[model samples]
Structure formats: structure tokens, C-alpha cells
Target: MHPVSTPTVLVDEEDRIITVLAGRPLGDDWDEVHAEISTLLHDAGPKVGKPRKQERRGDYTSLSFGVSYGGGQRAPGNLVQGECSRTVIRDISQTKAVQRAAGFMNGCFAAYAPKLYEEYRSNLSQLFAEYPHLEQIFPNSVFPTATFNCGPRVVTLDHVDNTNVPFGFCAIFACGSYDPVRGGHLILFDLGLVIRFPPGSTILVPSGTLRHGSTSTQPNETRQSFTQYCPGGLLRWVAYGFQPVGSAKPALRRWFEEHHDERCKRAVGLFSKLSDLQQDRQAVFSLKGSV
Candidate 1:
């Protein structure tokens, strides 16, 4: 393991690290990628909206930024439904957004940042081997699309990504500077680890194992990051509904029922408590049709 620093590298026995030598310029190709991102943000700006704040009640973290690119129109809506409570961008052409994102990523890799990109590639390759489902949705190249957001209000709570597929996700931190004291570092809950990223730094994580969140920012500071989901194997296609399952709904339902039984129990308890209160009170209440 490398000694910790403001910008440190963490490599476990199974982990890999890639380092980009300093002093190398990003080169001119990045200019084009930057321009395309700017255009996409500008065109998709109107639809970018803020998420509604709600009490945190789940075991997952909130998403601070969102972009409706790649896969389909599902990204933006999924963010909202997932209770990210903030959408920095939305409703852009998924294909265009991904192309620009991939170009930017490639540029980053070609620069002295080859080490970091190699680490990212290695992580993805490993994840693919473990989760064959990702191969179908991600193909050979993983070009994910995303948006950026940061502010005192922009927040992602602590949580981990679903582990149904194999590959871990890589996020490129773009746009703004990150201050450790400001609580913008990525907290790895399980390891009691925190990574404070500098602007343009990329972080690779085993999405399923790492529970992470962005701490609150400074009053005026903003954190911007772009996330890429690298599907591992055939499971990725199944997860995205790209492949059909014959009469698997029952099996899926049973799986959820078993895994989520605790959650269901909690909900049931809450419902029962509410019912008891209603019965104990003599207060007149309007009856809803279904109830």
C-alpha cells in the first residue's frame, strides 16, 4: 500500500494502480472534447433541474448530478426516482454525450495519465471476468455518459451500487477543485477511507464493495464529477432488459422477496403502527376511495 497523501493511491492485494507522470500537457485533442461537452451542456441546460429534498430513509446514497445520455431517456428519470434530489443536467442525446465523454476519457488516457487509465481498464477487465452479464451491454469499450454538479446543497449520501453485474464503475472528476476540509472527498465506508480528489482526478472503485458519499461542500464551492458504468459481462444486458428472459419474473420476484424481506418487514411494521393510531383516534377523517 502506498503512503497516504492529500492525493494518495490505495492498492489492496487485489487492487491495481496506474500513475500519470506529471508535467505532460493534455495536448490539443482535449480542446475538441471540451468543446463538445460544453455544447452538450449548453443544449441540454434547460432540462437540467434540481432534485427535491427528502428525508434520507434508505441504505443507499443520493446522486448529486445526472445526465440523460446513453442507454436511453431512462437516466434522468432514474436519477429522480432514485431520490438523488439533484439533477445538474438532463435530456441530452445519449449517443452524442457518450461519444464526447469517451473522447475526453481517451484523451486523458493518452496523456501522462496513462497509468490511471490503465488501472481503470484493469479494474473493468477484472469485473467483467466476475460478472459476465456486463459483456453484453458494455461491449468491448465502455463509454458512459453523465453530468456534473457541486455546491453546499449538492450531496450524495453513503451507499454502494447494486452488485448484480460484474464490473466496477469509474468516475472522472471534472469541472471544479475539491477541498478535503469542505467534505467533497469520496468516503469509502467499509475501509474507513476517504479520497479527496483534485480537479481532473479520476477515481476507480469497485462499485459493489465500496460504500461512498460526497460530504457537504463549502458555502460557495462546487464539485463536478462524471461517472462511467462499465458493464462486466452477459449480466449487464440482462440487467438493462436488452435480453429477454422467459418466465423469469417469478424467479426475480422471489429473489427480491428473499433479499428484501427485512425492508418489507420494516414497511409492514410502520403500516401497522399507523393503522393502530388511526383506530385509537376518534378524529373524523375523510376516507380515500381505495382505503
Candidate 2:
């Protein structure tokens, strides 16, 4: 399919992209798929490092795998969930289930927003060229590695995923046998839309800015969702020096100093800053940074 011709659930209506990558299976071999993902979550207890700091309660708990992004910070207004650091565990990235989850989201990025995906693809390719070993470190990811989340009854409260790139969409996949109507619907509070997100289906939301969450599940219905998102900082990190940057680096000062100018001078395509792109190439951004 022509990259431009691929289907998209444009965000113009209500900040959503529903089932852009429609009918794609979670993968073949349902039982094996189940086993691998099950081990990915249960292999460890609820590991820390969620974007939002949730109060300890029975109704909420999660285990995040893969790599870090713009997590452990604070936002404002409708998405004011604060951040706090905790143990960092990336064992899940090696697991097959999470890698497939990461791959699925990558494809969606390529399909829904080809331009941004090109940008993400360009930056990541540069990373691989310079680092070579980055290919092994982040095998399936093109930009920020997917945030592989596994949890039961993960009733995520309404909040924007502030960590994602302003120009990219967040990829989400629902798993488990949760009843759609009884609960487990992805709620876009701003749009008054409750998506009937069934198992094995993928949906996209502008989590970076949109206030979104899921309704509660029936007592017997279990809901486990796997999602992928890129932290805006990842774009900044790629743009700056493969290291975090900007005024918010009092804590990252030493690392920043060590690597600030250690960047390749490759031709920047979609990955270059939109402002710089406009000045250097006179490329006027339409929906570039709208989110």
C-alpha cells in the first residue's frame, strides 16, 4: 500500500485513532503467545517505574518492561499525574511477547502517520549507525522502545501521556478476556467516546496530550493491556546527543556535559526539529507538532 494511502483514524475529530492497524493478530499460536506474555508479567512482582505515581490500592497495579522514555516527571492541568523514580528493570524487552508488542506498534506508526514514522525511522537509523550495538539493544523499536505494560484490572485514571513525542501517536493493544460493555473500555474523557477495545485489537490515542483511561472491569472479567509510547524526551535525546538535555537537566548535568556534542552530522529528515526544518529547508509544518 502507498504510504500515503494507508488508512488512518485521524485525530481531527476527537483526538483519537481507532484500530488503525485493524485485524492484525497479536501473533500466531495463541497458547504460546499467552504463555510468553504471562511469564513476562508474572516472572517478577509489580516492578516500579510507571509514568504516573498511583496511590497504593488493590484496584491498580502494573509492571512496565522494555526501556525508559519521558517517565518519572510531572504534568499540569488535565494531566497532572506526578512522577517519582523507582527500580528500573528491562528484562521484559528480551521476552518474545513484549518484542512482538513493540513490533506491532512500530508498524502502526509507519501506517497511521507515515511522516512522523519516517522521522522516527531516520533518527533511529542514525542511532544504529553511530552505535551499531543499538540494533541489538532495541531490536524492534524505531524511536523510543515500546512501554510494555502488563497488569490485571489496570484501571488507568484519566491523564495525558506527557512522555510521548508531540508529533507521534501512542499505540495500544488490549489483551485478556474482558467484557467490553461491562467494563474495560478505553475512555477518551474529552471526546465522550468509549471504545469497545476487544482482545487482540490495536488502537491509537494521542496519549501525550489527550486525557484517557479505561473503565472498570466486571468482577470476573480480567483486562490486561499492552501499549507502546515514545517519550518526547526521546526525540530531544536523539536531537541533543543520544542523552537527555535542556533546562531540566540539573540532575543529568554530568552526563549531558559528557555527551552533548557527541552527535552525528547526518542529513536530518523528519527527525530534525520542525523549527530548524522550516528555517533550513523551508518546510512548513501542517499537523507536525499539533499534539
- To one decimal, what is the Cα RMSD in angstroms of model 1 from the true structure? 18.5
- Over the stretch 131-230, how does candidate 2's per-residue lDDT look in tens digits? 4433233566564444434555566777776667654667876666566667777788877877766555567666766678888878765566666665
lDDT for each residue of candidate 1 in 28-91, tens digit (9 for 90 to 100): 4543443444444433323434345542412222232321223443221222333223322323
Candidate 2: residue pairs that collide: 161-207, 163-231, 163-232
Candidate 1: what lDDT?
A: 0.40
Separately for all candidates shown, the number of backbone clashes (residues 3 or more apart, or on different chains) is 16, 3
The deviation in Å at residue 122 for candidate 1 is: 15
Q: Give all candidates' CA lDDT scores.
A: 0.40, 0.53
